[model samples]
Target: MSDEKSKLLQMVRDGKISVEEGAELLDAMDEPGTKPSGAEKELKDRFLRVHVDSAEAKVNVNIPLSLLKVASRLGNMIAGLIPGEARREMAGRGLDLSKIDFEELMNLINQGLEDGKLVDVDIEDPVKGRIRVEIYVE
Candidate 1:
């Protein structure tokens, strides 16, 4: 491999640069004179995509939601211990359990796929709707 390519690969392996970032660099290297491909350009906004594969009655949420809930509870406790606007901000934000539609999740997944990043998802029972979903940085 070329020196630059090797460097990028090493960074990805070392967790310094993400797979999406490495893909963009590779695209740029492949097209030395011209601009990056549309996929490469969009990688800047890339995010991991999660989807629920079950029907409306059996929506499965990502496992991370439980962890997020725990983290939020811990954050609330910490905010109580601290003082000032940080606590207020945490209170205002609440649990931040807002849900995103499947379309948005699909868009993020497609973007990640286009940019050559690993996309992961899970299916689980729903809390209120047919399905639950989550996404993250890859």
Candidate 2:
């Protein structure tokens, strides 16, 4: 439990505030734009992450979506860092990094995230490896 929430509950337990008022206070704490702490910090905006692990290999990638806007400037430098086999594996799963238009994709992701998570993909490929990809709005 968050410190604020715990304090609110304590207020109620100590008879310092009515249950209804405590409820209201708790509700207000959740208002958007409020600074988060503890576990809530984990829910903050973060780089898109891709994770892969297997007995034979492991991979971890963190990409800031904003960087994609400047990817053209970086040319193939970013892609070059990834192994060809991994790139091929991603392509086989219908995710062709080379073909993606980052700007357009970011727009679409933004639209999808207005409601909730935009994409959460988990795949276990017998030939390639295990993979988890998560994309979300901050």
Candidate 3:
């Protein structure tokens, strides 16, 4: 570890600096002009990941949080990419992608969402076996 970081950790451990303050100092050393209070690194470096697994197939998708700045366009592309059968299934489950406010969701996520799963869906398909869909922020 760098001496600066070691000293910062010691300060935090000694109660001379709060965790948030120490984090901000670290952020300042890493990036000169990053937003603070835990949102700095998240907004710039976090990602949203989607994993779909089934007996027949497995798919993994990773979208950087920075790219979500264009959420509206991305949302349309994402909605359009779903297969018709999957779209219909989602619609039947009252999850119409068209009605989702992706921009707003992105904004809310930017405000504070840390690393965690946002959605987890399990479906029992007659032929496809157990299918699982997981969406998480990382």
Best by TM-score: 3
lDDT of 3 by residue, 56-104 (tens): 5565655556544433344544555454455567677777655667567
Best by lDDT: 3
Q: Which candidate, 1 or 3, has the higher lDDT?
A: 3
Of 1 and 2, which scores higher on lDDT?
2
A best-first ranking of the candidates according to their lDDT comes to 3, 2, 1
Worst 10 residues of 1 by lDDT: 60-69
On the 0 to 100 scale, the lDDT of residue 15 in model 2 is 58
Each prediction's TM-score against the native?
0.25, 0.39, 0.56
Q: Model 1: per-residue lDDT, tens digit, 1-138?
A: 654456557746865444875576566556644332464344334333233333432222221211221222222222232223322333354522223243354455445434332323232324422222333443
lDDT by residue (1-138, candidate 2, tens digit) is 865466457746865445875675566557664445353343334444444444444544444343333323222433433445555666666765555575675556455535334445556667656644443444
Backbone-clash count (model 2) = 1
Predicted structure 1, TM vs. truth: 0.25
Least accurate 10 contiguous residues by lDDT in model 3? 32-41
Model 2 C-alpha lDDT versus the unseen true structure: 0.49
The TM-score of predicted model 3 comes to 0.56
Sorted on TM-score, best first, the list reads 3, 2, 1
Q: lDDT of each model, Cα atoms only? A: 0.37, 0.49, 0.60
